[model samples]
Target chain A: MNGNESVAYNLDTEEPGAEELRAGFTALRDRLRQPAGEFVRAKEFLIEKALLVCGMVSILAIALIFVFLFKEGLVALQNASVTDFIYNTSIQYEYDPVADETVAVGESTAYNWQPVGEEPKLSILPLLWGSLSIAFLAAVFSTLIGVAIGIYLSEIARPKIRETVKPALELLVGIPTVVVGFFMLAVIALPLKSFTNWLGLGTIYVDSYNAFIGALGVSLVIIPVIASLVDDALKAVPADLRAASLALGSTRWQMIRRVVLPAGVSGVFAAVVLGFGRALGETMIVLMCAGNAPQMEWNPFLSVRTMTSTIAAEMGAAQQDGIHVQALFLVGALLVTITFTLNVIVEVIVNHYRKKIRL
Target chain B: MSAASRKSLQAVREAVQKGDRAPLWAAIFENIVRGFTIAVVLMLVFILGTIVWEGVPQISWDFLTKAPTDGMREGGIFPAIFGTIFVVLFMILLALPLGIFGAVYMVEYVRNGPMARVIRAAVNNLAGVPSIVFGLFGLGFFILFIGRNLDYYAFGTPRDNAEAQLIEEQLEPLRAQYREEAIAQAKIDELKGKERGDFIRGYVAERMPAQNRKVFGQGAMFWAAATLAILVLPVIIVSTEEALRAVPASMREAAYGLGASKWQVISTVVLPQARSGIMTGAILAVARGAGELAPILFVGVTFFMPSLPLTEPVNFGPLVIQVVNPFQEFMHLNYHIYTMATQHPDPVGTRSIQFGTTLVLIVITFMMNIGAIVLRRRYARS
Candidate 1:
């Protein structure tokens, strides 16, 4: 309070205000010694490096796949012309004048993908369509069955029954897709063929089985996914909400339909999306059961080939850098694009629902 | 008023009682749908059962230990068993660390930023790619790289093979015009082979004659393992990421609060807790790796070989070679059971073996899955 009194801080000492200087230096040391700062810095650095390396590895793997496909596919692509490839001409009406009954000879087409042509006619449109059709069919059937099972497990069933049934259903997941294919090929395909023939629909082309068998087989694989995800999502809906709904005098079915189902709709959608993705990517069942014929027809009882089947079937013999190989890679790219788009859409929907519906 | 209320309740109960016993039509419909569901489930079980029944009766102790012979009666699955183990072990050796590290980085360290986002996107995309694509990749990338790197051993002189010889013959005329013609011709020849011998020797050295080891068998265990690794990586990464994500945030917070480093938190707290989940994922992955046929058929499954099963204590290769070719009955009890069961040969005699193999495969997968499930449940409860 006097001009003679000088304000002094320990950071700058003339004669050294000993206590103040010691306190300031100690404070500085403590700041440097905070464990939190060191931990954050190290953690951030390691994570950054790890993520970069992982990112590089993933990109490298995916890029390698692309390069290989393109390398092989390019060889196949060069072997055929675009026009012949797309139109896929088959010599159906051959000039057999000697027989007098106009016997048909081999045509430019049989099913959809006849890539093993002398001139190489690669019509993938039918196979793509068949792939989508079969996948869609499987998704629909599985979703319906799975939703019902989900409801029973989460809401309707007794605890004992739920426990018993849940594992049995999940056990289906352990069964290999190839085994499933063989099962359908032997049991479902043959039986369905006979049934169709007996039903006066013998002309329905069930002679060798078809996409329906493949779809059914795929449904078997995906149903478990739907059931599991739907069950989780439904269970995730707080029990209090269900109690509230029932307290409002709603019947069990009414409460489930009005409140629980809506609450878990997004999750159910995710399950279906995942199921669709599975159906789309499934190779073994479709390869075995769909007759491996890429037909563009809407007939479920007709033979069909999918993009996956085509790739699997022809990749073995497709000449290096040939036109056929290129088409196969193109198919891979197409599949990747379709699944990626579907995943994005599902994620968007999921994020949206999570934001919109707090419960 | 109480009487009226009681009467109303009684009326409601009577309606409920009536409703509990569904109308015949409704009952029929319910039964029909349930019947269909049961039928579908039964169909699945029957398929598995049939494969086991058919496949198991044919597998004997001798069949497992002996090398494959002329037909189903003569040979065993010793080679296939060895091949399976060799390929799987090598693949695990290669893929596990890579996939786990990648997953760890993705979940543990990576900030929720663009770089992490890109990595996540790559993983998501990788999971969707077909398994066979990996086979092709393995063929082109791994095989070729290995071959190019080891070309000296692949070719005896590193330049004196049919391809190289042909290239030299073509360049002989060019050598006369230039002083460096002979050297240029040799260089041209070397370029023509393009490490062909190196690649071939790496895979074909075991099978090829030492004097001429130019051509390599396309199918090899390394190729198989690499391809399988690619196929299973996506599954492993996805499951690992999910498992890592499931770890309680408080676990990490507590460790950090105790002045432990981030690595310590992950290694001690996060990893230990997520171990069971990771194991479950790996088990499923191995199951997937074992079941795949399409990729390996082209990449590694041998059509024929005439060497004894590589089962002796000294033969250290990952695959066992069958002294007899496998193509004849490929449907034998142990090896190629899946392939044989469904192939054109549909002989009545081989059905039992098919069933047995199916049973074996199913049992193995089921045991692993059950263990995983039980462990997961215990972890959850704890």
Candidate 2:
């Protein structure tokens, strides 16, 4: 036993006279009545109570958010049929003489929402297409640039350069998305439009310069995100693997390509997925640059809406029981589920890599 | 083609004496990519430069101080300046304590349990919800619930027509002549209600109708604050929790050994050490707050709330109001530039203005971010 334990043990083992034992027994009885363990246990219980309360408060906050959303969402869901809601391709019109009801006489499924009857053609397809197209484009761009930069920072760049660049990229995380959107819409989009016009590109002329502009903007915003994440993953590759590869006479680039990059592949994959989730859910940039079109189209040049843009644009006027309102909530739920799944998948992938590497 | 063959070939080449200079192709490729990275950085800088060049010339003391008038086609954003400040300050007040308290509870009190984990996960997800969703909730709950009472229920609607204006202009002198009579009528009404105080008696005669105009629109400042608070709460809570978690377990144990209570340990040992972290989170939250625009739309966020004396009825029909009013007019430096570039009535003014605003916004965001990072880094080291 350690020194302190031995002393305590020796003290316990010693015997004494009956009078001494009686006094010692009385002292022991008093000590047992007010055990140190009881104090520690009580403290632990209070801490547990505090933790429970903290957990409950957060739960309460989220519950309130869900309650508010579902209460309104259920009302909207009531009148909507499964087919009419997602597939009917148009709002229906009805008139009932018995009840003297004249329903909204919408025709040809003008998939537009001009609540004040200002813009008659309100289609969500275009906006959704735009959001997805831009987000996908941004993901592609960020992944390419980020992976390359991450590799450069982790393996290629000198220590000084990496030191400067790493913090610079991480700083991008703190920038507000709105500022990025504003920069793209005002500075980049206009110039690109002018340049494309000057180049006499009919596609650029016909399609959305704004959508492409927004994609580029969002890519810049998240480049740091992807780069930092990928860098972390790249760094996680064991140094011994690099040393062994070098001893085998492989060049730096060759060792990185064959050993380090391959070893860190899961992390890189996880980073891309994480970045994609972020890109999909970004609201402000798409809202500003998507031109708020809601029709479905495959063309990248056309102005389109995303689910997020639809929520931002329409949530203000959507009546609690209206189809438009329910659709927005549904879109939100869909997005949450998508991102949540992505996050879980990423966590599993990262954990698997960590276990495999054991570092 | 094969790796073995390639290695043998490399050895043979090295034995033959390779050139000192790197290959031309590799050099060229390196230069090209390096150039590309520089270009990206330059693009951001260029955007910021343009915004400053355009907007700085327009910014002046007079522009900052004078109230907006003449359909906000003229000078100043005094009301907007104050409104933005008040809204941001109020939001900080609301979010700071709650987020810190919640973080403390999570880190200090709770053990690793299933329920705690669930709550933590839920909070993380809630952080991802769009700010506009918060705006929608604010509109339904805050504006309709609270604003309705303050603006519509308590205050009478002011007359809007030219006829009413004519009547007011003509009746003013006559009302002055009949002041005693008006006072007597007010006193009688007050006594009928058995009012005990002079303030209540005077309130009936002096109560003005709600202004038809507002500083921004209707409920802009309050809703803007609420939306911002919601936007920053997650960031604050996450950062603060991380900070609190960083406190050593031994510190708590030591405090307990000294016979300190659980609350006493947290209040004395845990919180003081986490102060820098909490401050850093607060700064970052403010940085986030300044960049938000989506929720500003639903709240009566005008570019400028007209400068009215605080004692006067709040009216939003000023140039400051138009700045944030997306539906009607645009006025904040950002919105103004957006409109100038995209929806401007005139094209010549659009390009310059857009560039200027973009530059200013970039600079502001960059500075704020840098400040936050510095704070975060300092705390991290500690």
Candidate 3:
């Protein structure tokens, strides 16, 4: 660099040496193209690997859940059979006057989850019905109101009102599940009892913590889910399609019904399916508000225990390596399978919708 | 508007003149939607209103700062509040790193791979798994499997007591049966009394459970925090991913052109911009953790504790340090509300206090949620 400066100074009126400039430029390129230090490379490699592991942690956690559940449950099979998890055949003892012996009178198949006493019946049927019935009722109720609210928000409400209402819905969405359960038990029961009285239903007692209240609580929890999803579904309809429909002299309601809703039908159905799965898995609300009698009945007034509530109620008290804990694991496994399947179905529907809409 | 409005106006007028009801029918549909919307809004308001109406009057300075008294029928919820804070702090510390890294992995590396898709799907499904199922996983995996293994390897034979109990219970019957047979054999063959005793002891010892116990294997705040870290993993990942995506790609390209590495670009250019979004994820995770009761039902939540879940002072010769212990059971706000409202001996007397506790929990979660929403909105606008 000193020799180059002397050469430039000596040049005076003559042109500077191009070779020196080229050499300087080459030096800069040499510095520019080198790898970002060995230490940096090692650090980057290690960090990337660590992050990749972190990324897969969710998958690992899920696999561990499945593995632990099955492994823990397999031991209990020593005391309880697979058939015992489905239905139990109890030998009914009766006094037969003619035979003068109790003899093998009858064998009746029954579903029970009694994991204590002499006969540990671990049948999941009663819980299945309870989960399904409550979830179904919630689905029906939430879909009715939720879909309407979705349409109103997406199409009818003014922008300011929409902005206000959406956040309010979010606040509702953020309300803890247990709070909703408590409200259903302590508060909602009052209005419901009044309504029951207005209907003059004296013989039909409205139990405070029945499957009905559970359904109501679960539905309230899911309405925001269904509404937001349905809102997204409706919003996915292109603006041009909406404008094109309106230009054809259709009313806003007509356009929504005939154009937007039909176009977003797949997404809407996906939302409802997702909501049903959520309702099926809802725990605290059903646990707190449902009477949790674990009965199989058609009457909405009867108390019922869901798969989730049963786990929450029983798991803590279950002794380590016990049959009761293992039974709960089986229930957990069944729940994971159902929800996982529902999620897959929704993903498929959403992917199909995306592809169709892209075209 | 000029042509479409005039045409619609004429259509309405013509329909009215022809005594047609189709236009009115359309309006009726809109009105019905509005009705349902209003009804839903009213329902939500009624719920919130009921809580505020009953809870606000009961909340006081003592209620906020003091522990429960008279069997939780009187006094404040300070311990529950304290426990919730420490738990949330630990949960965020555990969740944020993995969540942020996972989001980075999805957004940067593996963006086009099947692995990312699988993880995305798994996380979404796991997010929907019942809160109680998380409790099960917490019990079975964290408390039973990992915690037991960690304790056995780190804290000595944690399973010894449980093994002893199981051996005692099972071996008694087996030992009795063996003794009866051994005694009969001894009477026939004239065997020694020591030999018969040895036979009974060996038979009992052989039936002992071989596997895994108590320290971390039981419900404690540590396992509760770990359980909640997994529970809110999905929320953190999704939000962080969204935040990462919000960072424009041009910045990364420019950084790369200047010879900056992938992580360098991310740490310097991306994370700074995505900080608010990551904060949003943390806030949401906190809200979910503090408000969630079912996930912690089996994971260390207790009805009440004489003291907080804090550690005893540790001597380091010159300085002693005492910190909140994550292994001990703690009284949590949500669990406190649960036990008092339903299981407390005198629910009637504790009504006001229950409402007060509910209000405090609600306020904490609501504040967290609002902060997340605000951060998200701000990020979106930027």
Candidate 4:
């Protein structure tokens, strides 16, 4: 018989070909099993890679934002020198009837931010001053109260009270910045102005919308942020430090002041810096309550325009591709740089202290 | 020598007695700090109390349902309420998946790699970027760039002349009326020459009907929602990461021991356990999104919109509502409050309405936050 027929005959007769058939069947099964294992491995690899890409989106977004802000803002810098734009303070935009245009009238050939004047001034100094003053005020007020609240929550408050009060304080953070601005404007500003008037400080003239009210509103927003951060920082101080101080015959306040505060000093600093970053970037409170008058005055009762307020107020009406729009973008870029640097610094401090504690 | 030793001993005894007398200075300092802490709490209570007291009077069934009348000095803020809800809902939908996926990747896939550190830094920086900056980004990227591109693709390359003509024709009567009013007012005020002309032009331009015009790369609801989604993304990611981290390690180990794949383990074991925390993160995102006004200022918010963002009732069927084109501008509660409080022609006259709008916004945001807090507590317990 031929080889194939002999094998079939052997299989039917239970001869040597039966062993060959069994070996072939076993080889086929192994081939199938190998691919199954490979499929599972392939899937695992694919999913892991996909998730990694997803995780990288935040990085991608940050990069994209930096690129876009610089690209748009650089257009303004090309039109006006950075030194002129940042250093010049005057915002006088005089209309020249002869030329049928608005022109910058001041003798100084420096940039000023008079977006609506015939000659638009793009100076950023007043905006910077306004932002800094209000943010400074907010930071000062919030830090004092926030640290106290943090201490209270971490050390003084009973456990049940802490649980209730901490979340309730956090709820304050959820209140919209606009609502805070509204509260400042409708509920707080009038009374403040009246009170100032009643005190016979009429010359001080707390404009319904002024730096003080703006700072007040902004402080409300920052308090919860600062409090939460400081609380976490204080909590992070090892319990042993407080216990040791207590064991040495110190009261709770003394223990906190001597041991916990020292240990968590870096964290508290980080909290303040982060709060400052928030205040610097805050827009709506300053927009609605800061009064959109770009001025360099430090008086808290006077109306001042912050960088964020200027951007929000003027961006809507600024002509697309015009110097005005580009200038607003430049302001945004400046904000990004400042806030970003502050964030990095705070992060570094926090990380360093955390590592130190771990060690 | 004996007299000097006795005098020193008497002085030490007086010092000890002073220390035993209640530590008055320490007590005073503690009370002062406590007073400041209580003041912070009082400030919150006072703000909420003021809003409720002033706003409760203005909140009525009709006020809640009707559109603003008399230059936004009176009537209900239905459009603003609807727009706020619509924008927040849209934001949550867009942000949740991206945020959850990002958090999962950070927590599950890349545990402690260099890439993870960089991503974390990026997120932290993003969180620090002000809401106003987000608005500018939205205005520049979403509207000027993306919206323009969309318009060019959807409608041909150039402006549609027919649509422009239709809008101008619709604006014709309104413009004429503004001109007449400006002339009459100018006459009474004895205004002269250029001043009168300027007044008429400004009035007509400011009062022109917005919907009649084609969506020519202006602010719109879709862009606003997109901007808000970006604004709250960091919040969602951080909270979601925290939630995922809270899931016990042993749960994952048990699944792995059963030969379950990594994906299976995460989906079945880890995700189920972390679901409530993720939900809490989502709710917080919504709360934050709902309260935000600055991000949408340049992106899409209108001072007043008579109709809802998505649809309006039309006599087409029993439940007849015509779908609002998504590109149209819309009002928002926070923006409405802003305009009423600050930008209204008669800001002093619109006080009740502003308080009412603020109250509604606070209630909505606080409800979401309280819900999230409750969810977190439940999760903590379990």
Clashing pairs in model 3, backbone N/Cα/C closer than 3 A: none
lDDT of 3 by residue, B47-139 (tens): 878788999999889989988877777788999999988888889899989999998998888886998898898788778787888888898
For candidate 3, the docking band is: medium
For all candidates in order, the CA lDDT equals: 0.67, 0.64, 0.84, 0.83
Docking class for candidate 4:
acceptable
Q: Point out where model 3 deviates above 4 Å.
A: A1-33, A76-78, A97-104, A194-205, B1-19, B155-213, B314-321
What lDDT tens digits, residue by residue, belong to model 1 across residues B1-382? 5998678556656756787532333334344445544654675677666766656676689766766566543566665655665676667777777777788887777647676688777777677665555655665666544543354365542332464577556655544344333334454455336464444434333433344332332456666777788788877787788789889899999877766767768888998888877887787777677666655645656533454324334434986543422112122122355455445355345545445455656666677667766766676676
**Per-residue lDDT of B239 in model 4:** 88
By lDDT, highest first, what's the ranking? 3, 4, 1, 2
TM-score, prediction 4:
0.83
Best by lDDT: 3
Instruction: TM-score winner between 1 and 2, please give it.
Output: 1
Q: What is the lDDT of residue B148 in candidate 3?
A: 77
Alpha carbon deviation, residue B328, candidate 3 (Å): 0.6
Q: Which residue segments of model 2 deviate by more than 4 Å?
A: A1-57, A87-123, A203-205, A317-323, B1-37, B69-73, B140-220, B308-364
Model 2's DockQ score: 0.25
Q: What is the Cα-based lDDT of residue A164 in candidate 4?
A: 80
- Judge candidate 1 at residue A162 and give its lDDT: 67
Model 2, B1-382: lDDT tens digits are 9998678557656644765232333334444445545555565556556557666776667656776555444556555445545566767887787678777776766546665577677676667555555665565455554554454334432222453476566656754555545455644555534453454435534653323433322455556676677668777888888888888999998877766667778889999988888887887787677666665656655444444324424456762322333222223444444444444556354454344444545555567677777887777776
lDDT of 1 by residue, A264-312 (tens): 8998998899889878888878887888766677678888788777776
